[model samples]
Target: MFPLSLLFGFYFVQFSSAFFGTGGIFGHVLRYQKLCLCRCGVSGVTQFPDSFSNVRLLDGQSVSPHQFPWLASIKIDNRTIAGALISDKHVLTAASPLYGIPPNRVSVTLGLHDGCTRNPALSSSIETVILHSAYVSGYSYNDIALLRLRHVVPFSQFISPICMPDFRTLESDQVASTLSWKWAPNSVSCTPRVATLPILPVWTCLLNRNSDTITPNKGCLGPLGIKSIVCEDDVGAPVMSRQPYSSSFRLVGVVTTANCDHTSAPYYTKVAYHAAWIYEQIRDDCQCFSI
Candidate 1:
C-alpha cells in the first residue's frame, strides 16, 4: 500500500495536474470512478474531511463560503444555473439551461459564494458548451452539459474540482448532499443553503414516466418533507455524495425538476450513467488519446 502522504499528495496535485496537464494516470471517467472497488485499493484512500455528518438536520442551513470549493455558478444571457467543477478547465452542469439556446452566450464564475457582495472569485469565457447527445428536448433524461473554460482554473481553498465516485462501487443507499442557493427575497442576490436528502428506490413512479421522450438517464431524490422540497430555482444544482471510507465528494446527480412542495420527488440527471460520455468529451477535447 502507498503511504498516506503519497495518497494525499496525489489527491490534490496528481489527480488535478495529471488529469488536466497530461502528466500521468489519466484514464476514462468510469474506470477512474471504479478506483475504490478494491477494499484495500489506492482509490480506497480519501483526502478531505466530511463537510458534515450523515444527519439531515436542516434544509437551508447556511454553508460557510469556503465549503464545497467545487461549486460553480453559470450565467447565460439572463439565466443562472449551478455547476460542479469536475476538472481544472471543465464545469459540469445541467443541459436544461442550454436546450434550444446557443452555447455562445454562457459564462461561468468559480469560487464565488455570495453574488450580492461581488465577492472575490474566478470567471472565464466559455470556450465550448457540450450538451449530451442523447438529451431529449423539453424532457428530463440526459440533462447534463459541460462548459470548457478558455483557461485552467487555478486551485485554491475556495476553488477545487469535486472528486468523481467509483461508479462500480456506489450502492443505492449512498447518502446524497446538495447545496442550494436562493435569491434573497425581493432581491437579486442569492444565499447559499445546504440540504441532505434520500435517493428514491431504483424503481419509482417517476421511472414509469409516461413521456416517450424521457430516457432512463435520470435519478429521483426525495419525497422530502414540504419545507425541504427542491424548488424551481434550484434546477441544475448538484446532488453530491461521499463514498464509504472516502472523504472526497463526487457529483451524483443534477436537478432537473422538483415539485418544491415535497409531494413529487425531484429528478436529477444521473452522473454515473454518463461517465463514459463525459470521459470521451474531455479526453477528445484535450486530445489526450495516445498512439
Candidate 2:
C-alpha cells in the first residue's frame, strides 16, 4: 500500500510540475496526495459524493461532472463506447466493440462528462488491444478486453482510475450499478447516466435464459422494466459496486450485452472470474488497494 501511495505521489508531482507549476497547485497536489493516503483508497477517489442510488442508465438521471472519474469513452470507427479506467495506462472494456476494429482506429477519452465532443487534451491513442484469448465473437463469454494507452494518464479532479474488485471478497447479492452515456433526445450531445442493477444468482440466470449460451463467467443484472430502452453505446461500460463502508467503487463487471427491453437482463463479463487474466496483464503497473 505504501508503494501504491508513492506511485500516485510521484505521478502527481510529475504532472503538476509539468502543467501546473511548482507553487500553488503543486502544494495542493501534495496535500491531496496525503489526504488520499490517509483517508481515501488510492484508486477510487472522486471529486464529488455518490448520489447515484436507485438511478437507471436509460431511464435514470444524469451524473454530475467528475462523479465517476474512472468512466472513459472509447471512440472507434466513428462510434463511441463506454469503458472504465483501471490503471494509469489501461482501460477495461468489452471486446465486442473492437471485434474487427484495429487499434489504430481506436482512441480513448478520459475526464469526460459529455459524449458528443472529443476533448483533445484528454484523449489518447491505443498502443495495443489485449482481448481475452478465450473471447469469442457474437458471444458474451470471455467478453473483456484491455486497451493499453500510448501515454500515461494524469489523475486529477475529473480523471482517475477505478479499483479492481478482489474476487475472493465478492458476494452474490451485493448491490451493483451500471454507468453509461446516451444521446439526449433531439440534441447533438450525450450525457453520462447511471442506474441501479442488482446482481442475480448464476443459477437463476441459467434457468431463465439460454442455458447453453450463458456461462458462469458472466453475471446477470436487471429486469429492464417496460420503460427501459436499449443502450447500444453501453456495450463496454462498467458494472460497479460500492465498497462497503467506504466511498470507493470497484469494478465488478464489464458489460457485454445491454438491452433495456422488458424481460431483458444485460449480461456482463464477471471481473471476479477473470481476475487472473486481468491481473496477469496489469500486475506490473496496477495494484488493487483493498479498503
Candidate 3:
C-alpha cells in the first residue's frame, strides 16, 4: 500500500490542477494514473441505506430533513464515495478525504438508488468539485468542500436543494438546547404548588476547542457531545436543521473529522463560524445558484 501521506500529496497535486486550471507534471501524472477522471460503478447504489434501519446496508431511509435523491454519491475514477447535495451544483463532503484534490477530476453522481445497476439515463453528473481553500488535514476547521456540476439540477421531490441556515441568528445556547434537550416541561407543572425547575441538559463534547493547538479556523470544531454529531462514512457531509415552522433546511455544521475507531468522539466544523466563507466560495465558484 502507498504511504498515506504520499497518497494525500498525490491527490492534492491532481486536485489542484484540475480545479485551478493549472497544468504540469502533477497533472500529467494524474492523467496517466487516470485519477483525473472517474465513473460510477454498478455497485455504488448499495452504498445508500435507510437512516432508521439497524442493518448498516439496508437500514430505514435517509432522514426526512435530508430526504432528497440528489443529495448523494461521490465519484472518483471508478470508485464512488458517499456525498450529499446541498445546492443545484454543490455536493458537500468531508474535507480530509478530498483536501488538495482537483474539482474536474472528481465527478458527483446524483439521483441514483443503487450501485448494482447502471442507468445513465436516470443519473446526473456534476461539473466540478470545489474543495474549501482553507481545509487542513487532521483539523476539523474547513473540513467541507462543494462539488459544482456543469448543469443545474432541476428541483423535484427526489432532487432538490437544502435550505442553508442563517448563521447570523444562530446562538451557542440554542445549539446546546437543540442537541441536548429531550422533552419540554409540562404546561401544568408551573401552576402546581410544588413544581420542579426544568432540568438544564448536559451535552457530550463533540469537538474540543482546547484539545488541539490549532487555532479555531473556518471549519474547526469546539467542544461538543457525541450525540451532537456522530461519525459517518461521508466526511464533509453537512449537518442541516429545520425547525417546525421552517420552510427549508439550513446548514448548522459539517463533518470535519472523526476517529470512529477511537470510540471517544467525533468532531464537526461549526457552520455558523464559517457561514460567510461558505457563501463566498459558493458565490465565486458556483454558477447554478445565487448566494
Which is the leading candidate under lDDT?
2
Question: Tens digit of lDDT per residue, candidate 3, span 25-67?
Answer: 5434443221211111111133334332221111112232223
In model 1, the number of clashes is 1
lDDT of 2 by residue, 90-205 (tens): 89999988987889999998987866554443989999999999988987789999999999777676777777776444646766877777623333336677777667788767
Relative to the true structure, how large is the alpha-carbon lDDT of every model? 0.65, 0.71, 0.43
TM-score of candidate 1 on Cα atoms, chains taken together:
0.75
CA-only RMSD, every prediction: 6.9, 8.5, 16.2
lDDT (Cα, 0-100) at 107 in candidate 3: 70
Q: Any runs in candidate 3 off by more than 4 Å, and if so which?
A: 1-66, 118-126, 167-210, 213-232, 284-291
Higher-scoring candidate on lDDT, 2 or 3: 2
Lowest lDDT sum, 10 consecutive residues, model 1, at: 34-43
TM-score each candidate. Answer: 0.75, 0.78, 0.55
- The CA root-mean-square deviation of candidate 2, after full C-alpha superposition on the true structure, stands at 8.5
